[model samples]
Target: MRRLLRTTWANTVLLALVLSFVTTTAVFAKNLDVSLTELFPSDRQVKTTLVINKVLERFHYRRFQLTREFAAQTLDNYFEDLDINRLFFLERDVTRFISNAGQLHDQLQQGKVDIAFDIFRIYRMRVDSRIEYALALLDQPFNFSRDETYQFDRSKSAWPVNEQQLNDIWRKRVKNDFLTLRLAGKNDDEILKQLRKRYEGIMRRIHQFTVDDVYQTFVNAYIRTLEPHTAYMSPSTSENFDISMRLSLEGIGAVLGADNEYTVIQRTIPGGPARQSGQVRTGDSIVGVAQGLDGDMEDVVGWRLQDVVDKIRGPKGSVVRLQILPKAEGTASRRLREVTLVRKEIALEDQAAKSSIITIPTDAGAAQRIGVIEIPAFYRDFRAESEGNPDFRSTTRDVRQLVTQLKKQQVSGLVIDLRGNGGGSLTEATSLTGLFIRQGPVVQVKDAFGKIEVESDPDPDIIYDGPLAVIVDRNSASASEIFVGAIQDYGRGLIIGEPTFGKGTVQTLVDLNRYVPGDNTDLGRLRLTMAEFFRISGGSTQLKGVEPDIHFDLGIAGSDQGERSLENALPWSKISTASYTQHHSINNVQHLKARSAQRTAQESGFQMLMSRSRILSEIEAEDTVSLQEQIRRRESDQREQVLKEERHRFLRAQGIEPVDEDAESPDEEALEKQQKVIDKIQTRESAHILTDFIQMQWNTAYEQRTAK
Candidate 1:
């Protein structure tokens, strides 16, 4: 229940649901006929579907079933899944499909899947016609001077009434594509070639989609209606899902899923090539992939997620180039970036807890030496532990070693930087919490059946009792939240930075083949949400993530991110607090807040970050862009320059050396490692914040000692 993409299948059906909203329902007199012959579902698919539905009914966190009300949701999910962009199916087609909304549940329960396939047939026909229109527009010269705007997000807009209206929309879409390339320095002929290839790629991919693809989409659409995290993987995607579960998989290290027509980056593995590259990010669209330094980019806009993943993965040490279309918050106009990464096996050494010592200058001549430990993840070697290996690798074990070293240096305070640390092993979280405080409950678990269990700290002795601060961000989630939440509840440390990613549920992977005996067929898997995690203080970290005691104004913080942003996510709730004694009290929280705010206002890095955040907000708020080529080009250049200048300024302020403009990295692997070093600088400012906190606490303690 962490901030994971949840197998290879969760959130795969989001766009479909978004585009399937009912704006104006119309009844059609046309008789739509469908039969099981058209579906051609395999025996495995039928059995898997039935078993998945049963699991959802019995063990899912959400208990609502395939009633008439839920059936309407299923129909909308189906229509939207088929035509997420609203470019293919006409208003009348949707109207004709509306009549079957109430009866879909009964038909599906009886193993009748003809409705989904029949609806898909109409969608295919519409796609063929639309592709022809889009292809025809590629030949015409567009008037760039016209001040016409294309609505990119048409989820709320009414569907096109006729073929003429739809053609007009496609014409604008093609022109916009041409203009984006033109601004990127492509000539007219080159633009035409690229656009034609891209459009044709879409057509080919649409036509090549197998029956399984339609079935998977429809089934996932239903699964998502139950909950955002519950998902059903197809036989082929199941293989990819299993591969994704393993940390040692040799690939680019980024999880991928379909978002409308694009393959979006879901989560970058903590020690993977993509995470180290600093070029690819969550929500970025991989539009094309190429091998080596100079290779032809394959247009992948309309390709399936499995196909995209296959192209990105290769032998270790090989380079893959990804054509990235960054996720624009509220606008459709986004610039493209190309990132190159050398594939490698994810090594545990790269993700181990790293320690550094910072000597912070305090009031007068006193100086405080603070220990900083950057924990990239809460990982534990389950196989090693299960085999009873004496030296099993885990966050708690690695951190203990680092703390021992820091203690030998006689550091006055400790800062556990959990920024980008998405949760891993829950046991590691509990054990790590044990390192700081005496034995107590670390977190609580509640199942759908209302059974509650409390996980304890699992240790009685405290190792380090000095002033501690835990730095977290929006990406800090699940097990991270459990640990951070415990620290705050026990009054053992100050929680710094943005709120944690609210993910408190527990998911178990159920193999469908297990239920159907004597079946050699691959029935895929179901990732079902069955339980929830809560803090020892009784507060649930579901939609409401753990709030920081000393909040920082980071760009991603306070934005519409985390569990609350997801649809059908569980609500926040509270239970009776666990019995635990407070470890220590800072006593001067207001003063600390005031002093930190004063310093942040004057800090050059923070100022630059705030400015860039404002620019991003403005960009997101914009509904239209100037169609004029010169205006568009100038705007793009200005935005890029501002960001570049701000980044350089921030780096200079942090006293970190910037990458040499003239010194290009020899290859992708070297560049990625270099980028990882650069990303670590951003955390330097957080270290400074922790230093300030320590100094403030030291001053207060020193004054109290003098008074005594």
Candidate 2:
């Protein structure tokens, strides 16, 4: 399962998932009596829901008690799930729902789910009213010169006080939508037509929502209230999850979710076409998708997320074109760009660890060749292993070979780049950690009942023990944290870059369909958080993650991007440190750090990266945009030009010539290769860091011999 960011909007957007399609565009009438009985969870579903709820209440690592407090939290979460932007439900509606919050626990215990349906009914009515008002607003011409701003992020704002207030909100929403299309180069008539279709699609999708859909959404809201990682996946979603885990699908390798009308990228799978293309990014909106190079673009803005995904997935070796609306830079508007990628099966080779040599400059007019191993994930072919394949693919096996090859090349130092490695098999993490160290405990696991299990290195032999560094970023998580933490604990290497993603809990998927007697229908699955990971140093890598010895602030850290940013995340704690020998200690890390700081201060590449971060932060913080088309276009173009200049300047400073301005744009293959080159700049810097480390080691050894 994809780990969702802590942003409420991101989670709520995912709830707008696969609703069964309906042909009719039913405009809901005010007096329509939508039956709550039909909208509630089925007997089997309710049975499964209750079973999982009980399990979480008792066996979850947090062991949260089922009390009125939890009940109220669940109630708040349900409202947020239904109407995160505070656009649909009124303050009165929320107040009325509060009276039912304290009774939710009792209701769930008895398997009475009328409350969810009742609240959903009110939400549906509100959506209908807003859609009607928004459509009516389009009838009047928008005043772009009014100098008004729309609060796009209203998740924290209070609900409108009255109908007129709500209408005013819709008025701005409609205007913003109009302005967005206009900025996208759409004319007045085309903008109106598209907006009308978008509103119609929203109504159609909501009307098509099944009882199972509503129940799944509400159950997930309840589950999330318990903990962010724990989740209930409906049967259909369970199948998709299995497919994702199997890595069998031939597609762009992106996890797509609905964000209002747009199908947004949730996460890009490692070794997938989307990730390889380097164009698709998290939060980018897929406005249009096309087949082949010359196929007509299919507008996907108002389509079902699953439908859009289907269009993107195809036979291996096929090309899919995506018209992307990048996440607005800060508060500025986004421009659309087209990216083409060839769909392919995400083979083991794609994610396997690879090695390269980077030459680090030295003071004596010499250079040290450092080996850089880029590990995208801690992956393993579980099926092959289960089938008794002796040569089963795994991260440790791949890296071991890469280290051997690098050693053959006579590289002076080593750096393992784990940035954006979200992690995979825990077994691989332990085994990989074993590669760089002698035998010892790699990580510890703590159960809900306080039983601690030590997972130790299976191999006593060290593969590569040269001067080493591990480069990580905010997306490095779970098993990545485990490996990096073990390295730190053992004094085996220096860690560089920002703190990791801090996801240390272990989750187990329970198939609910298995427990239902004689039920062949789709009974969902439950992902329950069962255990927490503790580093050998006694500290839990839960919320704190693994802090680097040398930190590089690429400006991506400290956002709502890690476990600590999550709501109700488990707190950091420590136990008795595992008894282990420190194979190698970095006594000169402070001196090395000082040298790195000096270089970073004067290095053009580092300074350029800092500038990029500042621009990104500014773009992210801007929640409002100017409605005037010319001003919006001018600001966007100016930002784009500035970014282009920064890129060229950085390249020139690195002694690499910038591409000719009038030259034809690179093809898909060239673009993918260029992405690899761009990614290696950091690796080059890491090699430099490792070079400093190696120099410090030699100096320390020489001084010790002289003193002796």
Candidate 3:
């Protein structure tokens, strides 16, 4: 499928998801209800509010306890752990919490009561004290160890973990931070700090990071008013997420999640350090991890997942020892295994576009070669750009380069594959479709104010003016739909896959800058869906993805996995007219559709795949789990295998010899015959077979252009 990096969309799939649509020419303000100084509370209110916040937080978290006393006791115990003195007059507050816990729970659950202003008044006072304390530390140097234990330094005994050390870390972060700042064209340190502070503040407001149980309670209360996807992640939790997204390989070499103390393995990425070792298995828990083969093993019980991830990740060729706690007990004592793995890219193939060629015989004359280009996503080198490189990686440029390469081979027709592509940067998709169409409007977006704007093709030069086809399944969403819809509307390509994964809307990544103290930290992306794209034909591609001209029996239906399946997604519908010149070439669509239908029915592979898909679908829908159920599953799977075997046998039984799935792949004998056939109008079985080869469909496409 052709995946697009452009963050564009269509249809009502997304809007229907929210159960609301913006009125035409409407204007509204986002109610970000926040007091900038909430986190930086007044000193007097800090203590009172902090205690209330923590108490409420504990109640919200362990709500299953139901009883106020039990929940309060749990909260008290938790605070004692963050700091012994954290719970000053703990018993008094615990007693008070127990008395009001039921009332608070009932009121909040009913959405009729809130003690927030009163509770937060106290919380702010305590937050003020905490802020004052945290700010104090900012002036002091960071703590350090001058001893040999500090590893990086030993000759000087050890560096002091004083304010100097804190300054050093801050200074060290400057390199990456300043890189971003420079790109923003900001230089003054004071201004940068202000921006960073604003970003950090967003963490506390939208994402409440509190040890205070009561504060957590209010945050959850606030969040419940919105949809399920909106959330408030703690500061520490946010930090952990940032690390996970950036981590590569080394160490124990596994992605993990926690089910209590067990570090359960997620998927072991192929060709990654974990997969290469071949010793680890999914469902295996890493009970212990050590830096080296004989290094001291640390039992990673109840530790944060990121902390465990840290122990297991390192530079390539590093050795990490792990004790695998068997998924089943009594298998063996924790097995100690050491794996020295080199870090490699796990999603390397997914990072770039892939291509293929399909050949099909025509009814009256010869076969056609159809080139398929599958773009995964549009990606950019953000780091390179931040590093002052004007020219860096981008999807538009990448597709341009790939299309040029395919053209050199002289393909007859081309199919842009955009299935399962969830959309990315808007710039990429807009530029990408321009590679096919001459300069004109590609997508028309209508904002809430009924402000309509037509985004024109960024480039006017056509890359290849060949017979074009676009393949999109239900998974082809957002930008995928935009490009496909444009090409189809322009009569530039025939969309041949199932209806796209319709995602009609555009989302802007809202930077949490307003709440941060400094831009140096707490930066994050919030994707907010807005606007919708309408086709020139007066139809929206939102919920209703682009339908193919040649409707082949691909095992996909809208209700099954399309945008229609998504919760809070947009719906399918038509829109009003926008003037557009109808491309004259589209008049032949009916004939093209008919021609494709007859050709597909004659293909053995198509028949076999459809039958296999049906059987698999049936097997998947079963509810049985007994040994008898196993028998049925085996029978179902075997049927698919048998069908394949028989087809192979049928080919062998024919005069045609067995060959790899690549047709027109230059068998020495075929190559010699090709020259003779090319020299004269020679009628031979091999020539017909070669012309109709489905495996090397690209070759057939190439021949179509040359044969003409």
Candidate 4:
């Protein structure tokens, strides 16, 4: 299971669970009236913290001294982790904590974490007070005619200076919440009932927080200050991580994370029912969940991630419905929609490499058959292989067979589509590259001590050597970057589409129990970023990912997404280029780009996609929304209409009928059809580009022969 799991999502899922458990428990446990003294760090947590500090100080890839500055930064991060929007913590509270920032380093080293608990107690008190205030506000009728604005994204805003200022903010907040539900067509009574339940749920969640949760949160707050990728998981979180790696859980295969109070969809697993549904997407917030078709929807906006996961996961073949707030709508928008999906086990076969043939018509009335292979992830059944099984399922083995089949079909060119492939096994990445070029170095790994190890393609055999192209998007990362980097460095193929996700660092899970020897206590685990990957060509795909030879506008800006956007992310660096042979040179890359650009401009589908991207970008740029009912309604309707028109235009361009706005969820056949249409837009274009490259190569060879 460890060998098979290499994607960042695994670490992300673990960290998210840790955060979710710690962040929401206090809100839910208010009714229990837990004593504040019980929330202090335990002896076990103290020992674990000391061990974690030692491990990171000695082995973490990024090295830094535990100075006052570092302590201050960690303190700030802890505050942010607890109250991301600066809603609960007042200006006085922040000022009070600032005095302890300089002493945090010394206290942590001495296994003292009383300050973490102190701040948490104040935060819980603030939450309880705010919920009561909000409940009281629900009794008064809001005047929708007033022209006002609510700044929902308060991450950058200053904390409230006093109780009055805080009250005003909450007043606007509760008003915005009421207006959102009213806009969604709910009556005043329904809106008031829902708001009261939501506020009370917040209190209930906070009351559920335990001492362990507080300890985990503080440790992670310190760890995250060192690097975004590194995290400390609790025992329960470690158990869940193991379950995910084993693929034994039955659920909608979505990796979830906490974005403030909402449980946002990080990424859907390749073989999961969520991925197959065509409704779930990264960044969508699951606000409500219901079991079966007729079950009443239970609101889960502020619920713990573990609680939400428990609800979403069920026996295979059972139905689960999700009320999603699409990410593009912004937090202020209340355009909630529900999607129904059947639970299923995420099987290995569903995520394996698959092949297809795309026929492109030529100017000479002949059709060029282009072989397309989609690799969802780089996977390997290591346990099966170690047992001496002759045919172990791996990305390399499966892709090698697929290449052979494509060759037998006499494909004019080949396209390896790696869009949304978050990456997996590193061994599989190197082995897979071997099938393309002769034996050579694929990637380089550098440890904290600066020791470099080169991973190379051991096999001297080449599978398919014809005109080749690799398609990548923002999601292609880790092992995927390793493979694509090698392909580009060797000039083995033309890289197409968006820049790859910059995630070149390597993480290893370390069991804390191992350090204690015979101790029976489950000390949880630490996902330590101990190494960094460098391309064979010298550059590291850390913050700046591999640039494609031919680019496509996929509605995403490379800078604002992926590893580059993460705080405390490792910077891009370089090393000496490795020794390797260039298989082929693409001399006409500029001409190919021009050809692709022309075709893209003429395609209606591309135009529609670009338009939709602009609309989403506009929405993402706004930090405030109008609180005036009529103004807000006008803006919302206009935005919805534009988005609807774009969708209809895209559907018409593809010769598919657009579903109505209030249409029921599409069945499997309809979803498959929609997926095919979406796939055709990109894959078909890639096939055309590959065909163009093939012709260019043929023409160049003919010219060289004539000259000779």
**Model 3, poorest ten-residue lDDT window?**
17-26
lDDT to native, each model: 0.73, 0.75, 0.46, 0.81
Q: Against the hidden true structure, what lDDT does model 4 obtain?
A: 0.81
RMSD each, Å: 6.8, 5.5, 20.1, 3.3
Top of the candidates by lDDT: 4
Q: Give the TM-score comparing model 2 with the true structure, all chains together.
A: 0.90
Q: Name model 1 segments beyond 4 Å from true.
A: 1-44, 239-248, 257-260, 281-284, 326-336, 518-522, 555-559, 654-657, 660-682, 702-708
| Poorest 10 consecutive residues by lDDT, candidate 1 | 16-25
Ranking by TM-score: 4, 2, 1, 3
Question: For model 1, how does the per-residue alpha-carbon lDDT over 559-624 read when each residue is reduced to its tens digit?
Answer: 468787776788899888887888877567776678777877887767666766776677655545
TM-score (all chains, Cα) for each model = 0.89, 0.90, 0.50, 0.94
Using alpha carbons, what is the TM-score of model 1? 0.89
The TM-score measured for candidate 3 stands at: 0.50
> Count of backbone clashes for each model?
0, 4, 81, 18
Decide which is better by lDDT, 1 or 4.
4
Better of 2 and 4 by TM-score: 4
Residue clash pairs of candidate 2: 329-619, 330-619, 330-620, 331-622
